[model samples]
Target: MSSEKIIQKIGQLYHQKLLMLVKDVSLVLVVVVAIVESVVRLLVVVVVVVVVVVVVVVVVVVVVVVVYSSSSKVVVVVVVVVVVVVVVVVVVVVVVI
Candidate 1:
């Protein structure tokens, strides 16, 4: 083969190699982008779940506090009624004697 023919073949081979390299680089970039997007989506879901749990816990706490306060008020009213009844009975017995 002549030198001119050999040079032309070498140039063609280099061009093909360059094209293959560009395709490989593009594939790598696409895979990296997909992985990053998936991680970000997962993080967002976790944050949303945490926020919902916190809100539910706060609502439950408020309800419990209100119930406890109402029960305490009922106990106080019962105690006052019992004391008044005892005092009235003692006064009636003294008046009869």
Candidate 2:
């Protein structure tokens, strides 16, 4: 074969290989991005859930203390009710979303 033709063939092969490598790398990057996105979404959900639980508990405690600070029995009943309501709300929220 002529040297010019052989050189052209080698150039074509190199171009094809380069294209294949780019496609492979792009596929890997897409998968990695999808996984990272999923993890970030989950972390965001967890943080939101934690914040919500903390806020609810704090509010309930404050309300209970302010309203029934002198009655131990009433305080206990209110606390138990608050706990059950919090649990139910959390479960419903989680399930709905």
Candidate 3:
């Protein structure tokens, strides 16, 4: 073959190789993008679950605190009533005797 034809053949082969490289690179990029998207979605789901758990725990704590405080108030009221009755009884007994 002539030198010009040999050079043209080399040029054609180089072009084909470049196209193949571009195709492979684009495929790799697509795969990487898909993997990243999946990881982001998974992270979103995990965050949602964690938030729900935290909210449930907070609500339970608040309920326990309210019940404990109310019961303690009831106990205080009972003690006060008993002390007043004892005082009134002692006063009457001392006056009569």
Measured with C-alpha atoms, the lDDT of residue 55 in candidate 1 is 51
Tens digit of per-residue lDDT, candidate 1, span 1-97 = 9999999999999999999999999999999999999997787667656655655565565556656776777656655654565465456544433
lDDT string for model 2 (14-72, tens) is 99999999999999999999999999789868866875887677677769685857878
Q: Each candidate: what lDDT?
A: 0.70, 0.81, 0.71
Looking at model 3, which ten-residue stretch has the lowest summed lDDT? 88-97
Off by over 4 Å in 2: 69-97
Candidates 2 and 3 compared: the better one by lDDT is 2
The alpha-carbon lDDT assigned to residue 57 of candidate 1 equals 64
Output the number of the TM-score-best candidate: 3
- RMSD values, in order shown: 23.5, 6.2, 22.6
* TM-score on alpha carbons, each prediction: 0.58, 0.68, 0.69
For model 3, residues 7-89, the per-residue Cα lDDT tens digits are 99999999999999999999999999999999977876676566556555655655566567768776566556555655655
Cα error of candidate 2 at position 94, Å: 18
| Higher-TM-score candidate of 1 and 2 | 2
Q: What TM-score number comes out for model 2?
A: 0.68
TM-score of 1: 0.58
Which candidate gets the maximum lDDT versus the true structure? 2
- Candidate number with the higher TM-score (1 or 3): 3
TM-score of predicted structure 3: 0.69
